[model samples]
Target chain A: QTAATPAPAETWLPTLQVDTPQQGFDLAIVMARRAVKTTQPDVAVLKAQRPHYAGDAARLIDVSGVAAAWFATIAAANGYWRD
Target chain B: QTAATPAPAETWLPTLQVDTPQQGFDLAIVMARRAVKTTQPDVAVLKAQRPHYAGDAARLIDVSGVAAAWFATIAAANGYWRD
Candidate 1:
């Protein structure tokens, strides 16, 4: 019987450095959930197009823009911007 | 003095129905943050491309895939999947 060789670790396309792996994974789940819901593309289409969309999205995250967006979102959630 | 007319409200494209706006916003912040880091594109280029990235990412959220990703993340966190 041939033993299966383990595959090399995947370098997640998004180059995030979260406090922990769990934190990053959690964020991915939340983001993925929202993304799927937002687009609501056909299941078959989504399966076919996931790589392209994920790749494009990863390439879009600007440091300043993401910082601004995240800050705005968090601030808004905390009612910092509204008052 | 001329008064400025308020613009129409934006209908968030992703069509998510979160329990609270904060939940959605928080998720958005997490996703955007991770995405921004993952790609690590030039700051100037990122600014020019934010809309496209966010839009494309939203479109990529697959129901089964996202659910699986999220579930796996949660399960891993709870040590359910590992021996």
Candidate 2:
């Protein structure tokens, strides 16, 4: 028998069911948290990182800016502010 | 002059204007890329990280799952798949 062709990478990506902007934001937060967990895996290391962050107001602002941008975009997609 | 009170942290976050799901997704991608850029900063370090990722299929799958979830949520928020 001939070798089977490999599936495209996109085909392997699962389609998640989401019905609302709130759900989208929730999923986004989950993904963001998972990413952080994966990257740092150690709570003690995360705690150590916090002290560096405490001194970096600019980084905090940058993070807040990104969060606000994400929130506004999600709001626009919902067509209104969603509870 | 009297001492000033500190403003709430949320007040410093900028509100980005986005009018569509496409805009939301685009901004998300920008934010994701920027996060990566900020974290690594050095191109050579990023390149080094690539080899480790290359051998990690599970991580790749996790990343794709997050992307698919985000896309489905965005589609739902838009009320349909959007171009």
What would you estimate as the lDDT of candidate 1? 0.41
Q: Per-residue error at A71 for model 2, in Å?
A: 1.3
- Per-residue C-alpha lDDT of model 2 across residues B1-83, encoded as one tens digit per residue: 33596655443215344445445444444454455767888989877886354334333334433433454455555453333
Residues A22-79 of candidate 2 have per-residue lDDT tens digits of: 7757644544444444444566655655545446776455444434434444445445
lDDT of each: 0.41, 0.47
Model 1 chain B poorest ten-residue lDDT run: B74-83
Itemize residue pairs with steric clashes in candidate 1: A14-B38, A15-B38, A36-B61, A38-B14, A61-B36
TM-scores for the candidates: 0.26, 0.35
iRMSD per prediction, in order: 12.0, 10.1
